[model samples]
Target chain A: MKILVCIKQVPDLESRFKIAASGTWYAAEDLAWRLNEYDEYAVEEAVRLREASGEGELVVLSLGPERAGEAIRKALAMGADRGVHLLDPLSHDKDPRQIAGAIAEYARGEKFDVIFTGLQSQDRGSAQVGLLLAGLLALPAVTTIVAFSHEAGLVTVRRELEGGARAVVKVRLPALFTCQLGLNTPRYPTLPNIMKAKKKEVRTIAVTDLPQVAALVRTEKLAFPDKRGAGVVLEGATSEVADRLIAILKEKTTVLK
Target chain B: MKVLLVGEYRDGKILPSTYETVAFARKLGAAAALFLVADPSDLPRFAGKLYLAAAQQCGEYNPEGHLALLLQAVQAEEPDFIVFLHSAYGWDLAPRLALALDLPQISEVVALAEGAFVVPACNGKLRRTLRPLGQRAVLTLQSGAFNADGEPAGTPQVAPLTWAGSAVVELVGYEAASRGAVDLSRAEIIVSAGRGIGKPENLALIEGLATVLGGEVGASRPVVDAGWAPHERQVGSTGQTVAPKLYIACGISGAVQHLAGMKKSGFVVAINTDGDAPIGEVADVLVVADLKQFVPLLTGKLGGV
Candidate 1:
């Protein structure tokens, strides 16, 4: 019944982003960091599974800079037994293969029954790490799972596919799943739980100490997506705006006709 | 460069995205090959080498089996680049194949700039150009990024592949998403809500606007995930791709996933407080006003008109 949930710290989506000085990613300064929204569901699902079993260790893992420890602490506050932080100051520069390889290196000997990860991180949005990690570990994996159930060493998950389709899949123990949104409502950390999470053991492993995996892909440059076009912005009184919109809709589109 | 384009077969037909991948390869101007897990009799007119594997032997949507087949095809063809559509099938299998081959993999490539792949990050607010370190790599092209004009010309030398791998994951079956009674795809006009709508109760205003416009009510992913709207009414990459005649996006900031669903609409109007929202980029008309104040006025005026 042992479960491992991999989490990541991502900048809040609402944050105003600027191209970093390195020209390969967003600027680190003035960005508010938080647990990746999708990973929260992964952690919540893992905690619930551990609680349902009534006696299993739940571990949360994160690979990021020093600030990522905050995300691990948040997961611990939500009921994970412990945290493992793969500390890398330049974690943002690593590609999905290297990130997955580092996690695989750490989890190779853990022998957890099931591993959980978010469908993708908000920053990188590659959606490759979980499956890559599964491949590296030679474990069966499912992605974008919105529903999950485990019993008698068999795990069933319903994956959200394109166009809102769902694929029901099953795998034996030692499988991996990438949790999607709506899987579960993540519980907020209570004050007492937060205090207790402060005491939870978080084992930090320097990513340098792990077997180095060469990055297969390198970020050449980062830039704002080109604007499709300059839109005609309507301002002033709401009534005036509505009037102009209706007029344009009638003139420009067949729908109003 | 030699490129191998993998086709996705589902429900006894090759998906349209497969041809789009061909369009991508054509755009790359590389010598290309096609691979599919389908009978040769029904194969599309591909202009290059075609690798075929019987679907029965491969199993429906079997990752391990597909990986084995693809690996064999890659070995036989010795392609420099392997391409797949950034689809459910590709998203699941490409990384596995990449890791197995010990090559780099890039997903959801929207464009190619100076030979580097351009992909969206930070929810499409930023774009990153990625360069593969090695000559051999795997890539998944974003849906709708490339246009397939027609069936490719010329005869393809068909090569059959075999897979002898044992399956570790079982496909139980598929459950169609409970769509209830709503189907956003068929709607002529849609008024979609987003997080900027402020609260669940604000959906009534969105519905009102939809009703006045003689259209269906649609919503972005966050609105549906927040239980402000039904799943069937969702319009996005993971939800439903809609190309309605008129799409009035209310309070939707337009994440890439959301834009993918409705970017094909005949005309778009986005009403949000944030003028800089990504929705403005694609919108024909951007109304920078609080939806709470603007939607009611717009709906009332449109209904009266």
Candidate 2:
């Protein structure tokens, strides 16, 4: 059995985001990058599945620039057997279709039993690439999968829905599933595993070599959210603040009185 | 601009966001029309055109079949803009249809003004204003971003669409997210906590305040994902939608998903340390202070032990 997990490196969620001088994207200087939170779950699930099966090769895939290689190495350290880096210079801002097309083109011939990706990237948050890749590959696709069990060429999964709903889907082998949060707690790599992961091979593929796809959308402008007028900050001790809050709630809102 | 509105339905009821999506599409100066793949009985009558495609296999929500049906509608109507509510149906089918038709896609649009859209990025830390470079585009409106139009205009021109395609993915079954011990949807007053509450132990403060106010406790996705709250008590795009008469938001930063669920409450009170949190926009009263200090103080003020 073979499993393919797709991951992307994103600016750490806690980082202070500033637009670049060009005014098109995030400032690259001094920004810390880490595996997307959802993608981390995907990698963890892939590793767990491989370990459960006990005989499959788990390959991690990422489409990004040189820095993304570091994320791939982390996934490898987590237990993936190998990594495939789809190297591209414009990794910071590739159209979802363009990215999906490149990945589908590369994976078409691999005939992996399953593929896993995050529900969406934290940075772009488009949440479309996985479904697009599924469409391109003509494979069954499930999104926002929170739990699943696999056996004998069949995968049964529970996908999240609005209003705390879960849909149980049963798909045949060779399907793609997008992992959501709460799927599993990712494992931390030990020192020995981290050292061994450095020796694992990450095959690099040039983005130019993949199928040509044009970007359907373009970024027009980037701007911060409009800052509202100064809110009335109730000051003084906690007792005073509580008095003021009660007064405001009773006078301005229906919470009191 | 001519717009095609993709309507979503589940279990024989048209999702409420469909009407709001029509209003949003209309705001873009497009003559919007509703494209329904399922039964239209649940959809309120509109003044615009209504296109129906009764595909037998599409009775259930499967992205693959929905995409094929939508592509057929796009080809037949030749509209410049296709609008869908940014729910599960839109999230699933829009990308594929956009890719198949070679059209630009704008996802999770919060506000639209004069062909330009406001979308949040960096986990709602920043908002970007974007315009599609092409004349044609597919757009998904974030839920609760627009108000549903209730005024009647005129009778709509109902038409049937011809669709023929097969879905690559088969529909198996669906299980609704379990309702927790307390039904948030029916709660008259809800006290919700966000990451701002600081720690799991702090939830006791929220529970105490809710208890004193005779309301139920709710939480944001991060709080629930942290295991401090159950998934059923979570409110947002993935969780329950509630319209309690009064909602007290403690330390919630108001991500779009979280706002989608509670935005319609009759009255809102936001307590947070950050003055600029998006929750301020919708809040009736914004109290800028640490929830840790304010919640306990307020709970004590309410005479809670």
lDDT of 1 by residue, A1-257 (tens): 88999999999876789899999999999999999999999999999999999887999999999999999999999999999999999998999999999999999999888899998898888889999999888889988899999998888898888878888888888899998888888899999999999999999999999999998999999999887775689974378788888888888988884
Error of 2 at B52 (Å): 1.8
The TM-scores of all predictions, comma-separated, are 0.96, 0.90
Clashing pairs in 1: none
Number of the predicted model whose lDDT against the real structure is largest: 1
- Against the reference, the lDDT scores of all candidates come to 0.89, 0.81
lDDT digits (tens) for residues A49-98 of candidate 2 = 99999997999999998899999999999999999999997866677888
Model 1 regions more than 4 Å off: A235-237, B39-41, B152-155
Fnat per predicted structure, each in turn = 0.84, 0.56
Per-residue accuracy of model 1 over B78-119 as CA lDDT, tens digit each = 998899988778888889889999999988999998778999
Off by over 4 Å in 2: A30-32, A190-192, A206-212, A228-243, B40-44, B55-57, B151-156, B162-167, B186-188, B197-199, B271-276, B284-294, B301-305
Worst 10 residues of 2 chain A by lDDT: A228-237
Give the interface-residue alpha carbon RMSD of model 1: 1.8
Give DockQ for candidates 1 onward, in order: 0.73, 0.51
